[model samples]
Target: MAPHHPEDVGMTAAEQPRQGGKGPRRAVAARDRTRQPTEVRRRLIVDAAVPLIAERGYKSVGVRDVAAAAGVSVGTVTYHFDSVQEVLSEAMVLHIEQYYAALSEAAEHATSGAEALRLLVDALFTEDTDRHWRMWFDFWHAGEQSTDETFARGQADRYTAWHRQIRALAERGVADGEFSGDDLDGFTARFAALADGLALQRLRQAPPLTTQQARHHLNRLIERELVPRSPA
Candidate 1:
């Protein structure tokens, strides 16, 4: 069995998509591997690639490495994925989805919108989340280096979804009277950008930033930003 990926932090085994019955057609699989649904098998291969990329960096991991990590033949990896780029792209998406999943889980039980946002702030700065950040930096770096428009668009889509998540939280707070923001668009932009900056710093370890320190800085910012100030 392939080791569980970060997806397990949020999505239970039952929740990840499984559809040999639908979706676009993939390469013809080997006769021996046919029993595994195409989508499921592809996910297996992609999941295997995540840890390898995390440990080896995106440019360094290859088809052979994925095959070995997946315990499948190199032919099997090629059969399921059209190219190394395709495999890496899918792996990036899968890993990123895990972060959103974990965020949703963190906010699921909060009693108020403010609490949910605070929970999200805490969720974003932990060591476990830091691992996901490493992959995020790599994906963005890859997007920057490649002129592939499709890959760039995918990167934009993921980022847009993240912005949407943050905006939705702020909207929830406003609607419930816990927040008063004059410009959600601006707030969302700044807040997401702040998180991105912190995540990058955490990944670099240039000043030896610890998880506690990261969460503390972000939580303080969240407190100062989210709560409306009283008029003089």
Candidate 2:
């Protein structure tokens, strides 16, 4: 067969303006290319499983539900996972990781520990985080009911990782003289628990906890936790 180029695809170098733009044409072409099959399928499965599991409890969402959501067959879902539990387990891990990535990205711009804390707290008590919080609730409810080994282990891991990140941020505040508590572990635990409680309330409360209201409340809690110290 003769060689084909962009020209063969009805987009020649000269005929189309060589503006070197990432315009819709380029985007469409990118989307048209063959993606890694395994990755594409796995992502489809995870993406489908997440919202369904979040909107409906994981226990309520079956292999058929995931397959329908992903626009695939039950056999396809099974091809990727042994069962719906397995898929939801994987989705939980992905969800937590993505959630942390978002928080970390927001924290990266903060120049001080106090600001970092503010950013983290603000991120949690917002409408944007509502879905993730709901997903966590669904996962917990499902785990409590099924007591699946994989879900249990994944939940433990995510919980540990989340606490670790929060502790690190608290430690940063301590180092910056913005936070003070002799028992840093205790400090972090209290803060984490408060954040979780507030987040849930924000999600479930009618009219919802306004982001500013949550942030102000968290700010006062942090202020109480802070200790005055000379700059390091």
Candidate 3:
């Protein structure tokens, strides 16, 4: 059996007018309905593409496959995104925004630097078996081969934004006396790098380390490295 598309599910084809004078009115209505579905269809395409890219790697998935998975035509996908690179780029941006939004909220509610760090760690590991890490690896692999300048710039911007946030958090820790006033830049870089490294390790290895182990190790490392000593 042929796969079904969204339009095929319930949208009826626009009917021809009985009189020539009425044709223009029907045409306008049809056009409006068609445009209305475009936005909904585009979101569906991105949602479908996420899991496909995560499982098959972005390089392996093609535009046609995304359309099929999204239950839309190839033309529909292209109408919303000029190319697969554009789709993947937008998807990456959406993922990063959603992840950071949650982090931002947690930070606002956190009572201390340690509390913020704990929330961050919990947010990272509390997801569905590190699905974000898998999607991130896929994005990185795709970004390496992409020739699109916009995509490259967006990728750099994401990393820069993340690093900036990490630096700000470290600075706050120092100001609050939870962390030593030692090299903020170094501390932020190391802290961010450790999370990325652990994510990679978990993605590549089987029998993944439990979330508790990750939290315990990270908390201990933060205490030993970042915490300030009391004044004599």
Candidate 4:
């Protein structure tokens, strides 16, 4: 998979739609891989930068490093991006967008609330996703020293947006009668926190939870806490 390509947790790439499209369709421009559009080339560069920055913090990667990774010249990198920081920042945003896009796609086709929750857990706990969590850990730590309000606020907004996403999903569960709870705000807060804590533990702590173990733990939490309401 390309660096920016989100994992196919519950859906294949063919099944995934481009933004705002009803379904996946063949793109005329995409047919010619040899001659990529400027936007596509820029995305390729950002994609290459993501895992590198995720593995070795933003300060460590230079324009030449990104250009080398992207299989492009340093001049190409400069042409597409203003600086190394711009490249890294754009890569971070692209990484997060891919993440949200994956979850959104999975949730769209989910048969039930339980299935949706399971899909999310599967997406989050994969071996490949470990890098994603580590990336966030690095991003959060860097934000601590950042004096740029715009940058810090942008990071903060993503967290708030994620919380809202979880809350919306929990509300859907309640509405579908799959989960028996009126305190959806509390449910969202708790579950989101649980996932975050688990991610950090899996990344940093000794004797880390294997992906399977982590998935089972999350599933159990949903099954126990979000009890099904029996039909009348």
Best by lDDT: 1
Supply the global lDDT for candidate 3: 0.72
What is the clash tally of candidate 2? Answer: 0
Runs in model 1 lying further than 4 Å from the true structure: 1-34, 229-232
Pull out the clashing pairs in model 1: none
Clashes of each: 0, 0, 0, 0
Cα lDDT, model 4, residue 16: 56
In the range 166-229, model 2's lDDT, one tens digit per residue, is 7777788888777665776776788878877877787778656876887787777777776646
**TM-score for all predictions?**
0.80, 0.77, 0.77, 0.74
lDDT of 3 by residue, 18-86 (tens): 455465333434543454466676777788887777677767888988877876668778768888877
Give one digit per residue, the lDDT tens place, for model 1 in 124-210: 887677778887888899999998888999999999999998888888887878767778888888888888888888888887887
For each candidate in turn, give its C-alpha RMSD to the true structure in angstroms. Answer: 11.3, 10.0, 6.6, 13.2
State which candidate, 1 or 4, has the greater lDDT: 1
Instruction: Write the number of the candidate with greater TM-score, choosing between 1 and 3.
Output: 1
Name the candidate that leads on TM-score.
1
Candidate 4, pairs of clashing residues: none
Which 10 consecutive positions of candidate 4 have the poorest summed lDDT? 3-12
lDDT of 1 at 135: 79
Report how far off residue 96 is in candidate 4 (Å).
1.4
> lDDT score, residue 15, model 1?
39
